[model samples]
Target: MIFIYIIVAILLLIGLLLLDFSLGKKNHRKNVRFLDFESTTGDYQIYTAGDPLFEDLFQDLRHAKKKIDMMFFIIKTDEISRELLEILKQKAEEGLQVRLLLDRIGSYRINSKVIKELNQSGVEFAFSEKPKFPYFFYRSQRRNHRKITIIDGDVGYIGGFNVGREYLGKDAELGNWRDYHLRLLGDIVQHLQSTFFDDWYLATGHHDEEPVPTETEGEKWIEIAATDGVQLEDVFESLICQAKEEVFIGTPYFIPSERLFKCLTDALERGVNVKVIVPMKADHPLVKEAGLPYMMRLIDAGGEVYMFDQGFYHAKVVIVDQQLCDIGTANFDRRSLFLNKEVNTIIHNPRFVMDLRLAFLKDVQDSEPLNDHLIQLFTIRTKIKIGIARFFRPLL
Candidate 1:
């Protein structure tokens, strides 16, 4: 009788595992969606410095007509953030609709008093996930990693420069930070606004109708690709599968999914030039350790990878065939691809792509070519770390 009971338990466990696997597959298929680029209808400018990006943001806020909705992963207490807060407080006082959303883990160091002040001053703000029931689970894991700013429902800013002096290359320890931030104008700002409210709605129950931008028509086609958990990986996988001739990539992290690895290798097999650039020194040592295997895999498959020697390369930029480009917050890692709320732009403009390619060329000039010998130099401890990190890659 005991043996019969054990057999029944084993069968039930196998059935449960199959059920879970089936749901995961279905959920992945249900999550990815893309907008077709009819034409380039937007005017966009890419910024690489925090100083310039903040200046433009402040200037827009000075002339903001209706609303300012912002979301970010990191909101450090730097001069830039302080000035931004002061201006936002002033703008809210002027009866403008202003809202801010930040990741609970990313902005964990932010003081509650500052938050209270913002609240009392009528500047609406909230963390992406609060420490309450149902939300606390995976609150730290599924972070809001996107950095986006939309002003007056007409203009938008997207890409990697978070609120800090390091982003502007002011930190002595980490000098000359390189990243990409784009200024967007046109109907696409409406899509950016929708992305913001998607999080705002969850954070604050903001059920208000989406605001319609009053901007003039644009000259090119721009589509926003934003997702949270299980979908972003597919976005990049599709992007890689569609590449032709050439592909340039920049990011701080690189832990490609199995599907992504296959797509990149396949792109190379089709006679495409695939260039991947990552930081020399990662913020998380474990992250760097986790990615070495994939980096070697790409190199072994006839792709080129580089390590930026200037400073921490935090920009997530992808330029394909000098005709299609994507710039925004998603990195080529498990966190950005599968566990975070990310926003990226799919742009189809040859002229813009050319400029982006130029920027990438400049960065390549400053980076060191990566090879298998370099990866093999890591200490045994690091190898152990890589193994452990790989075990957790799906959740990292």
Candidate 2:
């Protein structure tokens, strides 16, 4: 009788979760907003490694004259993040506006004591996407995966590098972190500053000051594309469909939706070269396995796939025909496509695009091709893992 009662309780819990998810999905579908900002000019500096990126970012933060706004999916309570927190505290104590926004579930490791310290120092801090009643499960699953920083309306930082020791290649397990980050200077900062304020409003329910616009321009042109859980698929689809010569994708996760998979295959059929690079190391269970089927399908369709071997490939980049590059926090997975709030920088500068392409090719050189020999090594256990991954694809 006790066993039967336990089973009944389990079923009831699962039913409740399903219902919450359904309700959240309906609400999310209704609130989907796709933003297309006007093209702006900025001078950009790209960072592939973490140490220099942090050094420059920290310097910029120290020099902020008026405001510092930062939002990230994950911020670890480690050495690097502690340093950043200290910086923000100092800035806020100096009477400068300093606000930090972090995802609720992603930055769970940051304890209350740290937050209290920041608050005491006059730093405005808020967690985005807190779970609510009637759709707790769904809200918990959706995340704000964008990483952006705006300072003084003159400079902007956007990319995939989170605040952590691992991001600085200090983790023993995941050695040598690899990612792509961009530092922009000019009128483009206004667009990203606007994004930070909008997100800040959503997270804290408080209106912030208007962005301070700069009248600077450079050769590089960019558009900041933002998606509210939905509409990202259409953005990616449009980019892929417009590919005329080749497509290069680099991401940590590669579990594409059915429609997205079809888009890739269709691109291949139309003689567009499609190449993808993903990490050989699995950061999360079932995520690597979840991408196996999709990777195999791409390989079978004459697309080239490479597994990054030097370190974890945490970059989210897509290059089309050496003319356009999309780089941001969104992964090539269902979460980024249909659930997470994501922002991507679309670059239309030929010089920058060509430079990024060369960097992509260098990483590809450091990768191993997914050929027949690698596929032949899969055992029955691997097959079972793939099945489990497919079952939990949405969560991954």
Candidate 3:
């Protein structure tokens, strides 16, 4: 009888272990391969400065007729946040369905009082994966690092703008903030709207009251690529492999996995022109040091690297062969390409490519080339930090 009980206990333990592994595997596979959104043509505009982006966002919110769905990584107690909160509050009061999803850890600085007021005013809000001490490693680490807005399901937004004064360059310490955002219109908006509901459903477990899907007519080649960081590795490599002439990437950080790094260097070996632009002013201090090894390796392999001096270049975009353009919230770093949830819009329109190329050139005018000499000047203490940074690249 005692032997039978022992055998039962061992089997139960094994069953529990297998269950945990299966659940983890399923969660990692949550990143769908591709969006089956209806094909449509629409006018897409790129916003590089904070002032115009903020103005356009506020206007969109005010013009919203039915619903407003917004998700962001950070929401501070800055001027912009206050203004946005006021607008969202007003909209909720006017009976427009307003849903907000924020990353709890990213927006930790947000005032509890403001959140309470918004809740009382009928602004439905919830933080994505609110951090807990026991489950900090896996659960809280995978943040909804995506920033998107679906206004009335007709207009859509994707890119890297959070509600903060730093994005407007208002903070002297961070200097002038330079970021990129996209204002999209068309049936493609419907796809993005539904994408928001996916996260909303996970956070709240009920999406019956989610924003209504809206579609429109069009004829452009725009595809939405969603990722939880694992498949993004393949998407980027495949995208780079298709480049014929040149590949230009603009990102705030550069911390890709080893395999992806080889893809770029290999492309360079084939005489393809490869250029990358990263910010001189790092929002995260250690990030600048962490990216040095990758920078040096790329430069050594005949690839070019540039440091944006105008301000913090927080734009994550890629243009391949002047024909293919991809822009969204995913950076070249491991955090965006491996750990966090991110989205990028892939467009095959020449007009859109030209627009992005022009913006890249304009930004280049404000950038200075990066070389080995600059990287070697770091003190031994900083080198120690770089070594530590390399070990924790995925976490960054």
Candidate 4:
């Protein structure tokens, strides 16, 4: 018995050491740098609304002399997707290299006619890793939940908004999907392009171009961080740890990991005003049920929680102390933290931070307050369902 105990202890120590080493390497990989737009002492223009965003992106694609790459989790056959496809076809015809990567599961319902048309037009496309078995297990659950667009290594865009009518406020059933996307113009575009290439290679087994960090003659401080596999241990935790006074979070899903839950609770206890906004009518019933227990705990700890009652709230944003902001496709749920390939940009700009805070305040106005009474209104059966859902939250 004594010898067995000693062997067990030795194994545990070795496991811990391995974990620490893996975490360190993951952190190093997570550190990404881009030219800061706010700090750059140069002339820049700010564009908002779907029309402007699409216009700029199309113009870039039309004039692309080298490369155009795009990756999206979902790309419905809506007006936006049609316009994008037209532009991509035109670029391909002009002899510009155009590549598209879409998640197979998210774009499962995409119109086959549109895909066939694009293929005939000479545009190259690939779906994120296909499942080994289609009808047996939950293989499709591991999705490439990233939305990125890069053009000629000079411009890029990343955020939660997918290429669909719902994202552009056209889906009648969804009413209006509130989301956020950022257009980046600087060295960071290289990283965005590289991310797309990695996914493309994974899917098509083809190597296109390698990303080389671009040189910009301006001062801009930007960092791109992502979480996937075992690489998530520090990215989200570090952002939470750096919060000083106030933290504002907006996400569609709220099933957080254990360490993240504790960090938010601790921050609230330290007198930090922690506010979180989630969708009242979630698309996934299981996620809605799994999120309630965490909501109750947060409310009990004096943390502010809001549920957007207007439409589907799909933005993923975190503003810390009104000085730093992280905007991307990553949610606060377990899938984003541990399973999905997610990307985020950390910006240390007062202008962007202030604008993001203002947007959050606008969203808060449309959100309903969550409290204990609301949570207690569920029936016993619903409560049992919720409990079971929570048990599988991490897996979901």
Candidate 5:
């Protein structure tokens, strides 16, 4: 009798969780905000190394004349991250109007005491996507995955790299972090600035005026695609559908939606060369396992897949036929497609696109081809992880 009672209680708890999860998603859909800005002219420099990226960014932070606004999905509570926060604090103390927004779940390691100190220091720190009532479980899973920084309304930074010692290639297990970031100085900075303010409004319920648009020397054009937990899958699908010759995808995670998978296969049928690269090892549990099925399907369809062995390949990039390129926070995964706020920049310049493709090919040269032997290396434990991961794919 007690065993039967226990089973009933477990079922009841699961039912309640499902109810909350469903309701949370429904509520989120009602408040969805999608912003697609037209292509604007900008000058950009790409950064693949962490130390140099932060070095230039920190220098820019110190040279800020007016205001500093920053947002990141994750900022670890390590020495490097603390150094960043200290810089922000000093800028704020100097009356530079420093505002920092962080995803609640991603930066949960930042304790309340630290938040209090940042606020006390005039940093105007706030957490986005706080897990609220009625569906805390589901709400917690939805994240703001954008990593952008706007300085003095002139320079802007966007891409996959986040603040952590690991991101600086300090992790013993995940040696030599590999990623991409863009430093922008041009009219395009205004668009990123506007997006940052919009997110800031969502988090704090406060509105601030935007700065004047800055002029650029470069003539290259770029478009901004910002999604609020919706539309990213369709965006990537459209990009892939337009590919005439080839498509190169690089992401840390590769769990694709059914529609996306079909689109890739269709591209393959059309003689488009589709190549994807994921990290050889996973930094998170179950993520690599969840992607195996999709990887296998792509391989079966004559598409190519590579496992980046040089380091954890965290670059979220897509290059189509050397004509277009996208670089930003959105991954080729469901979390970026349907569960997180993401931002990506679409570049139409052939020169920039080719440059990115070259760098991608270099990374490919450092990676190992995913073949039968690699698949055979999956042990029983991995098989179990794959089974569990498939069951929880959406949340992954």
Candidate 6:
């Protein structure tokens, strides 16, 4: 009996060690391919609806063979929105594994009828955790800011596009909302599928089987990194630090953490030509207020900052050294850094980065430079509000 006990203990120890080793390997694997969007996914389709991309996404949904997993921050009820919802319901009724996760805050305005309809249709759905009480204090800040859809574990879509009529240019007020969405193909879809599964399990307490590999011939390397919970590995921070010559960034919001702010200032001090473009009229008023002081700091530090005048600038992108770029749903703010679940793809190809640079230049033509006079004109009341907002910036 004593000998058997010793052997069992030894076996358990070995098993734990093996488990740790496997997890480490998964975390450190070097299968990441960094191709620019054009070179990475060759002969791929581009859509600017009423264009092919929009139609292709729907067509992909219509032809899903095995499964469809989707996660979004918001899902509004509009014409195009309802059509997509109905298609999802049809797919679920057809015995496909359709999973949907939506942020409670972003979709708070969605009608209960839509929720009931989806549930009755056998479509699995979950609302991310809502604060029990004191809702404004806790739940109001944290958001699941990822927009992703994976089909058959072979094709994936990620970027700033959300599911709403406005996103499709169908809303009267928000008809011309400019945004971006990317279609991805290749081995990277597995990572996207897994990411969706992880969020699904957290929301619905169910897990799908591991995705099977889909065969595709490509040399474009891609890797996705997302941040959630309190523990994150700061992949965005590392990407920013890797910039050597130029860093071009665009976002709808700009309240960055102190560490990130300092990093940008240090990079500029080291002679990097750092440029950031944000909107002059933000969709969120408080975010705009919180960004002013930081924008002034960046300007004083010799960083070039532009406030886009074109209708709400809702893109979140970062191009580093004109060789690597990241596009996704994360804004450069405290909310995105610590509160929200954000997804970003790091691409290491020059052609893709150059294309993004061209887009940025076109946007700059419509942007107004951040000048010292603007910073000096803040009224006392506005300054007070900004101070309070900055004090609670982390919670936001």
lDDT of 1 by residue, 133-185 (tens): 33234344567788888887788899988888888889887788889899988
**TM-scores of the models, in the order given:** 0.89, 0.97, 0.89, 0.83, 0.97, 0.83
Per-residue accuracy of model 4 over 1-396 as CA lDDT, tens digit each: 999999999999867655654454354346422222222221123332456666776787888887788888998776788888889988888888788888888888656777787778877888884655322123344568888988777778888877777777676776667888787876766666667776787799898656855444324556776545445546777778878798899989998888999999888878889999999886876888888888888999989899998888988888999897878889989877765778777777778788879989999999998987777688898798888897678555
Candidate 1 C-alpha error for residue 51, in Å: 1.2
How does candidate 2 score on lDDT? Answer: 0.90
Tens-digit lDDT string for candidate 5 (332-352):
998898899999999889998
Full-model lDDT, candidate 5: 0.91
Candidate 2 worst ten-residue window by lDDT: 209-218
Q: List the residue pairs that clash in candidate 6.
A: 33-221, 33-222, 34-221, 47-53
Q: How much RMSD separates candidate 4 from the native structure? A: 8.0
Judge candidate 6 at residue 114 and give its lDDT.
82
Write the number of the candidate with greater TM-score, choosing between 5 and 6.
5
List lDDT for all candidates, in order.
0.82, 0.90, 0.82, 0.76, 0.91, 0.74
| Candidate 3 residue runs with Cα over 4 Å from true position | 1-40, 132-135, 209-216
Candidate 3: the clashing residue pairs are: 41-218, 41-219
Deviation in Å, model 1, residue 135 alpha carbon? 7.8
Candidate 3 per-residue lDDT over residues 46-114, each given as its tens digit: 888889998999999998888899999998887889899899999999999999999888998766787
Comparing candidate 3 with candidate 4, which one achieves the higher TM-score? Answer: 3
Against the correct fold, how does model 4 do in TM-score?
Answer: 0.83
> Which residue segments of model 5 deviate by more than 4 Å?
215-217
Deviation of model 6 at 329, angstroms: 1.3
Q: Select the stronger candidate by lDDT from 3 and 6.
A: 3
